[model samples]
Target: MSIPFDRAPTATTDTQLSFDSLGAPLHEVTFVIVDLETTGTSAGKSEITEIGAVKTRGGEVLGEFQSLVKPEESVISPFVARLTGITHAMVDDAPSIRSVLPSFLEFSLGSVLVAHNAPFDIGFLRSACERLDYHWPQPTVLDTVTLSRRVVGRDEVRNHKLSTLAAHFGTEVSPDHRALSDARATGELLHRLLERFGGYGITTLEDLAAVRQAGWAKRQAKSHLAKGVPAEPGVYMFLDGTRRVLYIGKSGNMARRVRGYFNASENRGRMAEMITAAQEVSCLPCAHALEAEVREIRLIGELAPPYNRRSKNPERNSWIVLSDEEYPRLSVVRSTTALEKSSAIPLGPFRSRKSAQAVKELLDTLYPVKRCTARVTAATLAAHRPCVSSQVGQCGGPCAGVTDRQTYLSGIADLFDAMGGDFSSLRRLCTQRMTRLASEARYETAAEVRDAMRSAMSTAARAESAQALRAVPEILAHSPGPDGGLDLAVIRHGKLAAASHVRGSRAVADSSAAIRATAEWVPAPGPFPADTDSLPEETRVLSQWLQTATLITEQGAWSLPRSGANFHAQESGTVRLGDAV
Candidate 1:
């Protein structure tokens, strides 16, 4: 659904589905009010003694389903006989549960199942389906007990228990611990609750589903915040009273998506907090889902909205940069701007600074690369002495003048080759080091070596993927739009430069031509292009889009590395491309 950006959607809104658009009106919905009398409380241990249901629509009775199910193993206790006026003798003549369950299921098919305490009755029915090997028609369920709690205040009804509600509502049929009587009472309660919900504009089955949600009143009251929000694919921002953004999200349907935040459909605890703090909902509608996603990523990165857990600080991500110096060394940096300043190749824009450091360590371990932080030059190298690392053979010690500049530089070249997806040397060295360490019983050090090796391999894989697209000077691609038609995008050097949405074959061609002509001029990217602004994420977004996109035009070779970052140990010290080992 990822499409180009900044274009007015050509697809008509009428065809787009939303929550309200799909719900069945309450009056049109058939509700099967059911009640079950069981020998015990637990569905696993209990046996249904009787099944009763009343199917109704628009307060009119459509049909009634009732059956007495004789228990196979257990008989009703004497206390239950006094409550329901039924016992083993009474159910002896009745059909067994296996014979009665199918008929009851058929009677309630295609209807929203309702019960006074739904879980108990529905659980028993579903459990019966499992035992009897009958396919349970997983119908929509409505619990009058939940509905009454939301509709009738505690002041009006002391408790939501069936007997309490039946008495409070003065039902024609009072619940008497019998299936038929309780079901008839529950049917009356359903209608009364529906009437109450109508006052709050809960006119459809979807609305009723939210009645059971905690903070139903608060959600209903805040529903107006969604007003005027366009029903289109877009990014939404929930702002607090001071107009500070509390949350940012994207959805195919902006209005419906935002509205859901104030409804039962959204149940995330942090979202509930965000909704409570939110005083206004604003949106930036897009042409399609992809544009929405891109905008969302960019916004989250730029704003770092507190509620958003991902992509908060694209700037905070760490990268392993090859330092631009007389004696080059690996260093961890926060921005890709270092790429523009130095002849350094960026290895990653890893989410964790620790992971980036791990890659640096892995590279240093495999190659006798410099580990010193001091800035050294040819002038300073003659005055320097061999460091501790040089004595231990971990570093080339170019600063000490012991290792010639050319020899140290040659080692760096091999290190760069490994970072550039040729992980053969790194794999072999780590494998040998790990085997040697385990033999010496240095298990923890071996584990550290393994982790560093993995971190390095992952960084290499990502760099390979990104560089493949960055090498392409230009690419024209199209994907199916959200509703209908095509989404055309012009990509330059792995960056989205222009995008448009159009309908019909003629319009697609026209838009494509216009987008290509008007596309922004982009210079060819440097090796290991930095993650400044949205470069890395945008490339990732484009890569995903191109995976399924139809290419109409291209410039330059857009080739990925042979194995692309799937580095694994292979025979003869060679590495195989697959998942990293």
Candidate 2:
């Protein structure tokens, strides 16, 4: 009787899954041992005089096929005839090469092929098939000579030739130049080589094919190192004996990804150095691919592993934060701490500080906002005269009371609107200024306007990316696990607040509990205008995941801003905000 249980499963190991799941057991693989006695060596010049084959599986012989085919040549070579002991009369009345091929191919249609040296036999077979308009069955082929070299080693065996290896392995059938005898010897040699392969953990045709290269065979023992890593989506770290991280990476399958580094075909220069230096591998399981990706970046920035070339420093981030003041002014700030406490509208997590500064400069020229930092009181505002910025018409002159508080605040309000993807006023002003400068032969001034316009649009795009995620109040999403189960995540207030695993029949209950646990939990808004490193680990991880999440509720869907990049295209005529008094 079979019993069903709902317990969560432990992680699957390398031995259980192996390199990849083999479609069938090795013993069940059908093998056709083939030997061809040709008139001479080269398939282009020589013709096959005899064909012999034995089909077997798991060391049991299933069938045999033998044929003597008449060559196009009138007589065989004296040396070949003597070596193979096949006279001309033996094949004189036999079927032709074309006629004999169909019967042999039909016998071995679905079998793996084994030969002393496969290329020599396959070449002759392929040549005949090509010449006669016959389709060659592309069977899985193995070369016993190559296998013998790996199995017995050059030190143990005199040579890899069929006759020499056959005697050494003590096969039941001895090798003679005759086709049938050589075929039987090869079949026995194949079984012995396969048994030796088992010692190296090669059981299937894929394993045999993989280990054919000396590089693969040399690293076979080290392949077990992959066994320690679990198969799941997460960040993997390679560390040296001193416990220092050599390299950090993320993948959908941590075990599979780590295993690939040790593969024979690995050709990266730094990868070789990392592999040799690394003594242990560490993994941190993530809720999903997005979390894994963010964690990878976070780790690189925090540790600054020498092998990592990207996202090494989170401190390099920049943001355009609207100031928390009576007369608000947009300023580029690198301090995440100042941003979060200022209660200002934070519009980035930009890649660089210069990019944030560009947008700040663009907004300042596009809108008539006060720039003087002196605390503004009705008494102080009336007594103070305008600064040079006011004289130049760069500001509305709020400090001099030339502009009323409500009037100046209205302009500041418009700046906030511009930051939220409405760039109609800014675009019009920038284009008009550019056209006027170009018309007056001030080409450099025109280029500056053009560049500022681009910076404004690019900044708008980055803000759009972040705001879209914030529109969703909360999300409960699940991603598929390696074992037909789900990895769950709970994002509250647009930040990944909690994550857990639920396998089998407990998905619904566990998912609800996970969301409820974080219901009252408000993740910190976190230090803004700073690099990825300054953000709380939970916020960084969740923010990345939410970027790609599918919001569940209609409230979440309809909450997003309807405007896009096209919203900026609404400004058609050139604007003269810069020249306006």
Best by the TM-score measure: 1
Off by over 4 Å in 1: 1-22, 210-212, 324-329, 337-344, 361-414, 428-455, 521-523, 527-533, 563-581
Global lDDT of each candidate: 0.77, 0.68
Off by over 4 Å in 2: 1-25, 38-49, 71-88, 123-138, 223-237, 247-278, 283-467, 470-473, 479-487, 491-506, 515-529, 532-555, 558-581
Per-model root-mean-square deviation over C-alphas: 4.8, 11.5
Tell how far residue 125 is off in model 2, in angstroms.
4.1
Q: Per-residue lDDT for 482-564 in model 1, tens only?
A: 65777777777776767667664567776777777876666776553443323566677877788789998898887754544
> Residue-wise lDDT of candidate 2 within 336-426, one digit each (tens)?
6767755345656566787667667767877897666766677876677787778899998877778876888876676776665676677
Predicted structure 1: lDDT: 0.77
- TM values, all candidates: 0.84, 0.57
Let me know the TM-score candidate 2 reaches against the reference structure.
0.57
Residue 377 of model 1 has an lDDT of 67
